[model samples]
Every structure is written in C-alpha cells, then in structure tokens.
Target: MLKLHDYWRSSAAYRVRIALNLKGLSYESHSHDLRSNAHHDPAYKALNPQGLVPALDIGGHVLTQSSAIMEWLEETCPEPPLLPPAAADRAAVRAMAALIACDIHPLNNLRVLRELKNDWQADETQTKMWAKGWIAEGFTALETLVGQHGKGYSFGSEPTLADCYLVPQVFSAQRFGVSLDPYPNIRAVNERCDDHPAFVRAHPRHQPDADTVDSNH
Candidate 1:
C-alpha cells in the first residue's frame, strides 16, 4: 500500500496530493501537525531527512521533495500525463512549477515566516506583506504566461504539472490575504481546476487533518 506523510495546510503537500489524485493512485494519509512541529519527529526525519511533509512511501520506496515525487508519479504512471510530451512544452511546465516552488514559496513558507518573526523581529503585518509581495510578483508573471501560452489550463486544455503547483500557491496566497484580482488568468485556471475531481479531493479542507487552524491558516 502507498502511504503519504502530509500536513493539511502545506502547499508542498497539497501539490503531491493533487498529483496522486490526478493519477488515480490510492494512498493512506498520515497527517503531521505543523503547529506542533510534528515534521521534526524522529520517525518522520528518518523517512525524510529534510523533515518536510508530503513524503511518499510507494512500492517499497520512499520519496521526498514535492517536485521529485510528482515526477515519479508522472514517469511511472503516464496515462494522465501531467507534462506535455513535447520537450519545449515540458520545459515550460517545469518552469512554471519552479517559479512557485523555488522562487515564490520558499520565501513565504511557514518556516521562513517564523524565522522572519524570530530572527529578524518582523511582526505579523510585515510577514503578511512579505508573503503578499512575493505571491503578487510570481502571479503577475504567471498571468502573462497563461495569457500567452495557456489554454483552459496552465499549459493546454488539460491540467499539467504547472496547474498542480499553481493551485496550492493560489490557496496559500488567499490564506495570507493576498489580493488575486490582478491575475485574472491565474484565477480562471484555479476555477477550472476546482471543477476537476482530482483537485477537489486534493483540497486542503478535504484532508483529515484539516482543523480550524489548518483551514484558517
């Protein structure tokens, strides 16, 4: 059986959830409470040295990193391909994914936000602004890409790896009070993703660990 170690409100975990659901894979969910630093527990650390959520145990192998996990699922189960077959198209999708995971998310993740408060003495208002700024910047570029290269989804008429990364980022932005009205294309793609069963099941609120803190956070 497949097992996924995840936290409900984690954007990285949410990406993996969407990929797994998009592939129609069945997995058991083990929820970790970020509020309590459950990710740093010895048991989880052994599975993922980085002590992050969305670790996947599948077919006797354990995988870490949301991007790596999503790629594995795509390579192993190719029916509902998350990336286009064309090399250029694949590159474009990967670029979009990187924009969120590397450029945007790292700066605004829970750990970064907490560090800003503890180390730099940034208040809630400042942290919120930090998150909002990064998200708006990323979304601005993504919106332009969507207008130029997107179809009904991020890349084409069908959902792709880019969409998986995008949905979670949008959700995180909304949680942090970022205004998304400037990115109509991003919101349109998000609305399209919302109608898909895979995206629906992968929603943060649908996870078992979705309590008030997780949902509102």
Candidate 2:
C-alpha cells in the first residue's frame, strides 16, 4: 500500500494530493503537524533527511520532494495522463511547474518563515508580507504566461503538471490577501480546476488534519 506523509496546509503536500487523486490512486494519509515540529523528529528524519512532509513510502522505498513524487506518479501510472505526450510540450509544462515550485515556493516556505522568526526577528505580520510579496511577484509572471499562452488550463485544455502547481499557489495567495483580481486568466483557470473532484478532495479544508486547525482554505 502507498503511504503519504503530508501536512494539511502545505502547498507542496497539496500538490501531491492533487496528483494522486488525478491518477485515481488510493493511499493512506499520515498527517504531520509541521507547526509542532513533528517533521523534525529524529525518527522521521531517518525517513527523509530533508525532514519535509509529503514523503511517499511506497513499498518501503521512500520518496521526497513534491515535484519528484508527482513525476514519478506520472511515469509509474500513465492513465489519465497529467503531462502532455510530446517532449517539447512536456518540457513546457515542467517549466511552468518549476516556476512555482522552484522560483516561488522555496523562497516563502515554512523553513523560510522559521528563519525569518529565528534569525531576522521578523514579526508575524512582516513574515506574512514577505510571503505575500513573493507570491504576488511570481503570480504576476505566471499571470502573463497563462493569459497569453493558456487555453483552458495552464498549459493546455486539460489539467497538467502546471495546473497542479498553480492551484496550491492560488490557495496561498488568497490566504495572504494577495489580490488575484489582477490576474484574471489565472483566476479563471483556478476556478475551472477547483471544480474537479480531484482538486476538491485535495483541498486543505478537506484534509483529515484540517479539522485540528481552524483552516481558512
């Protein structure tokens, strides 16, 4: 059986959930309370040296990183494909996914927030602003890409890897008061994607651990 170690509100983990649902794969959910620092526990560290949530223990072969896991899922199970068949189109989708995962999310993740508190002594408001700023900037660029190049979804008419990355970022943007009205194309795609059952089940509010907190998503 597949087991997914995830945090309820983690955008990275949320991406994996969407991918899993898109593939129609059933997995056991293990919720990690990131705020409690459970991911830093020594035993969990043994599973993933990075101590990140959304680690997949598939038949005891551990996998970490959301993008890596999503790609692995696509390769291991190709039905209802999440990526385009052509190599160039696949590269384009990967590029859009990376724009969010690599260029945007890393700068504003939980570790970065912890650093802002511990090292920089930033208050909660300032930390949130930092996150919002980065997200807004990234979304601005993504907005252009989606507006000019997008058909119905981020990369094409069908939901692809880019859509998986985009939806979570949209969730985060709404959380931090990032006004998305400026990005009409992104908002439109997000609305369309959220209508899917896969996206609905992957929502932070619908997660098992979400009841533990008064989640706004």
Candidate 3:
C-alpha cells in the first residue's frame, strides 16, 4: 500500500489527493498538522528534506512534491489520463496547472501568510489582502485561458491535470475570501468538479485529520 504524508488543508497535498483519486489509486494517509509545525519534525525532514506535506511512500522509495507525485501517478497509471494525448494540448493543460501551482499557490500558502503576519507584522486584514491580490491576478489570467480552452473542466470536457490543480486552488481562494465572480469559467469548472466523485472524495474537508479549527491558510 502507498503511504501519503498529508495535511488536511495543504493545497499541495490536496492536489495529490485529487490526482490519486482520479487515478483510482488507494493510499494510506499519515496526517501531519501543519499549523502545529508537525511537518518540521526530524523524522518527516529525513523523509523529505523540504519537510513538505504530500510525500508518497511508494514501497521503500519516497516521492515529494505534489506536481512530481501527480506526474508519477500519471505515468504509472495511464488509464483515465490526466493529460491530453496531443503534445500541444498537454502543454496547454500544464500551463493552466502551473498558473495555479506555481504563480498563485506559492504566494498564498500557509507559510507565506505566516511570514507576512509574523515576520513582517502584517495584520489579518493585510495578510488576507495579500492572498486575495495574488489570487485575483492569477485568476484574471487563468479565466482567459479557461475561457479559451475549457469545455466543462479546465482544459476540455473531461477532468485533467489542470482540474486537479485548479480545484485545490479554488479551495484556497475561497478560504482567503477571493471572489470567484470575475472568473465564471473558473467558477464553472469548480462547480462542475463539485459533483465529481474523485474531486469530492479528495476534498480537504473530507480528509482524515479535518477539524473545525481555522488553522488553514
């Protein structure tokens, strides 16, 4: 069985969960409370030097990084493919995924928000505005891309790697009070994903360690 080092609200971990569910692969989840700094423990550090969530223990070998793990899943389990067959289409899907994974998510993750509040002495309002600003910027660009390429999902009628990345980011955006009204395409995709079994099963709220406490970013 695969072992997944996870945090219920980590969007990176959330992405991997979506991919794993989409691939119909089962994994054992080991919850690490990011708000409590459980990820910084030496044991987890040894497992993944970066001490990030969503590390996959595939038998004896381990895989870190949500994007890498999802790519590995796509390669290992090709059925119900997360990427398109055509190279150009695949590239487009990757670009959409990167818009959320790289451009948007990195800036608004828990660590960055914490840094803003703790290191820079930003109040709650300022931190929220910081997250909202980046999300709005990214969503502005992503809305155009999704409008151009999306049918029902982020790329085509079927869910793809783009959808896997998009859904979690939407969750994060909602958490930070970023409105989805400006991006109907993005909102529509999220609405479509809401009914998807894979997406529903992989939601952060459904994770083993989910709690009512407002500890997420």
> Best-fitting candidate, measured by lDDT?
3
10 residues in a row with least lDDT, candidate 2: 208-217
The global C-alpha lDDT for each of the candidates, from Candidate 1 onward, is: 0.91, 0.90, 0.92
Using TM-score, rank the candidates from best to worst. 3, 1, 2
Candidate 2 lDDT, 15-69, residue by residue in tens? 9999999999999999889988999999999999989888999985999999999
Q: Which residues of candidate 2, in runs, are more than 4 Å off?
A: 212-217
Better of 1 and 3 by lDDT: 3
Query: Per-residue CA lDDT of candidate 1, range 157-184, in tens?
Result: 9999999999999999988998778999
Give residue 79's lDDT in candidate 2 (0 to 100). 86
**Candidate 3 lDDT trough over 10 residues, lowest sum:** 208-217
Better of 1 and 2 by lDDT: 1
What 10-residue stretch in candidate 1 is worst by lDDT? Answer: 208-217
Q: Note the clash tally of each candidate.
A: 0, 0, 0
Better of 2 and 3 by lDDT: 3
Compute each candidate's TM-score over C-alphas.
Answer: 0.97, 0.95, 0.97
